[model samples]
Target: MKKLLIALLTAASLSACTTTESFVKGADVGWLPQMEASGYQFRNRDGKRQDALRILKDYGINTIRLRTWVNPSQDKGSGHNSRDETVAMAVRAQRMGMRIMIDFHYSDSWADPEKQVKPAAWRGHDFAQLQKDVYDYTYDVMRALQSAGVAPEWVQVGNETRTGMIYPEGHTDNWPQLAKLINQGYAAVKAVSPSSKVVLHLDRGNDNQWFRTWFDNAKANGAKWDVIGMSYYPYWLPGRPDYTASIDDLGRNLNDMAARYGSEVMVVEVGGEDDRPQNTYDMLVAVQAKVRAVPGGKGLGVIYWEPQGARSWSHYALSAWGADGRPTKAMDAFLRQP
Candidate 1:
């Protein structure tokens, strides 16, 4: 009877773990505060005025992703993801019962596959100082968030670092150096908030070879990360392949990543052309299913990039909000049941 009771208790504990690790339905709203400051108003499907974050919550978004830039500009569309702003936003989202994922761009502007320009202040620093800069900056941000009563569930060391981050010094070609820099960020994150998972992000989620090569190099160089974050934007691919053509590849890659590294995987960024709400909705649904299907539940979640940044406001074509101030039908994809 004691053994039976122990087994039952173990099962209940497993069930509780599963409940706590629910699939994340999230949005990267780094541009939200700027948009709201510029006088943009968000409305629900019924066209009633509403707080933008609340509107997102009602659309089934339970997680919020915000980017942080090192010395950002104040330009309307090109700036304002400073540390203070990020902490404030995280607090607001947390108050609304949303989980937070913090993306570190490590640049004054955007940081991605094509451009990872070093921040102006860090440009002149030698390799050793650069590593120190990465660690100090990451530590400062994490500490600030902690002091604000917000603990990020995931913290990206760098954004879309397909080639590597912090430019020539930290580029993938110099994997050894890049690994050191990455480790600095990872160490800093753990120092401030040990439970927050550190993510090593890359673009092209469907390309398994690319991911394998990059991660293999990272592993050999002793870089550390808890999650493999991917950006899967079919519309942004060179030929603009349809999501249907590559989604299966995404699924296979997600499973392979989980099995290969024994780490959680997440479609940290995804989007579709704003004009085709139906198509975008379908793609989002499929993407979530693929993530959910990862064996042992290693798949963490999907987060649409700046979904509330309407085309009219940001001149971006992938947002899920309409020019009419209402969320596009694509936002409803998150509302669908797994």
Candidate 2:
């Protein structure tokens, strides 16, 4: 789907009715299939077990986020998030009338600010070869998704990459190399689907200074991206500030990023502990409101990260599903009318 602003401009003439754009109320349920495979079931409000996608849809979620890891099989117990598996998940999500956001880890496993392990195949390659590898891998993934009729609406070049992606070569300290890799991914996404918005993601939703430093260097080095994606986990973010302060800070930071980059922003990942369902619900409510209040409606969306994850491999604490298989109050936040 086209972005909010682009989709709203219907004609040059004034109309009595204004077309309101849809906000992306989304969920990063990348672990849903895997959790089901491990015998975890998700129950609807009626307590009846249902397909994960159906349950999310019933709760009013309009988008799904999936992460892709290259050569995941390079290590034992890896490969579950391989390109093929990601494509299958995207197909299912699209079939359910949900838009898709593909997040590229660009590694064999999780690639965060602290750890961005290089894919085994590209470890020994020189800088030029590494750039080509990134371009080819990204183009191939986009082509496969397109062929399967699951082309994504948004594509993230990397995940929670505050420092950068693909350790050493593409690390934040090496801004030129990092920007080249990011530009490669952006070009690949456009080559396959011009409508797909490319996102440059980073963690820390409240850190405006971090965003300025990172984005300044990226733009100076010619990085190409359309949207700014941020991960906001209140319980896990550094400092553990009060919820109200965190929400206010996030709003300020988002506005700054949108104004600076002239791009829309989204909380691509967000979660809070399930132990306090009410607290999580309140946080989500505030966050949704804050995002919508961004100047010029530049705030695009908010996505819950692994909201239905039960018995997660990582023992995640922020999932909204209780042990009884039913969703917690946190999921209801998405039901709020915009």
Candidate 3:
């Protein structure tokens, strides 16, 4: 009887683990609230007006990614991802039964490989104070979400920090400082929401060597994170190579990052040109396939960056929405079986 009970318990443990792992189909809709506020209506393929989030959910997006900026400008084209806005959006998405991923840009505006400008409030702070700022800001945001009954499942410490964040202060040239800043954000996230997985993101998902070099340095400098987040944008890649030319590399990189670091990996951002819906659809399908193929279920998800930010309003070409306020065929890629 004891032996049989032990076997059953072991099986239950394995089953629980399996059940906890889910392949995330997510979209970064940081611009959504602004879009809606600007009277941008979203419609399904059938042309009936609908809530943007509902349209996304109907297309199989189970998760919503929101980016929060520090003291963001109130500009029409480039604002409105503030803490209050993020919390409200998360609450709305949570109420809709969608998971949330909070991306901390740690800047007043966009933070990416090309730029990681520090918020104006943190401008003159020395390294030590900057670290404290990162922690306090992260903790405050997490606490706000918690107070609003929204707990993000994944919290990105920084967005696309290939050269590092916070400009000259946290640049890759000072890995030690950057690592400390990352740890501060990670610690704050865990302090407020213990179950939230911290993500460290970088651009160039298909470049295995770049990932290796960046992560190796991060590891050496004691940067802690739960997931390796990557941005894969073939549309922006130099010479604009087709997805076929580099998808295998992305797959290999995903597998390698997982095996090498014992951490889950996610394509946190990916998008193709909006004008080429079929090509974008095929690219998204292939990207999801690559992520799902990662060994040991280490590929957590793929997120479309600002998919609903229609080209008409945002002038960005990578969105999956058409000028007519309907999702293009590219959005259907999420419905494809893995």
Per-prediction TM-score: 0.94, 0.91, 0.94
The C-alpha RMSD in Å for every predicted model, in order, reads 4.5, 6.1, 5.1
The best-first sequence of candidates by lDDT reads: 1, 3, 2
Tens digits of per-residue lDDT, candidate 2, 73-102, equal 633234478888899999999988899999
The prediction achieving the highest lDDT against the true structure is 1
lDDT of 3 at 72: 95
The lDDT for every candidate, in the order shown, is 0.95, 0.86, 0.93
lDDT of 3 by residue, 31-58 (tens): 9888888898889989999999999988
Error in Å for residue 140 of model 1: 0.5
lDDT for 282 (candidate 3): 97
lDDT at residue 211 of model 1 (Cα atoms): 97
Q: After superposing candidate 3, which stretches have Cα over 4 Å from the reference?
A: 1-21
For model 2, the stretches where C-alpha displacement exceeds 4 angstroms are 1-21, 74-79, 311-314
Candidate 1 residue-wise lDDT at 183: 97
Runs in model 1 with CA error above 4 Å? 1-21
TM-score-based ranking: 1, 3, 2
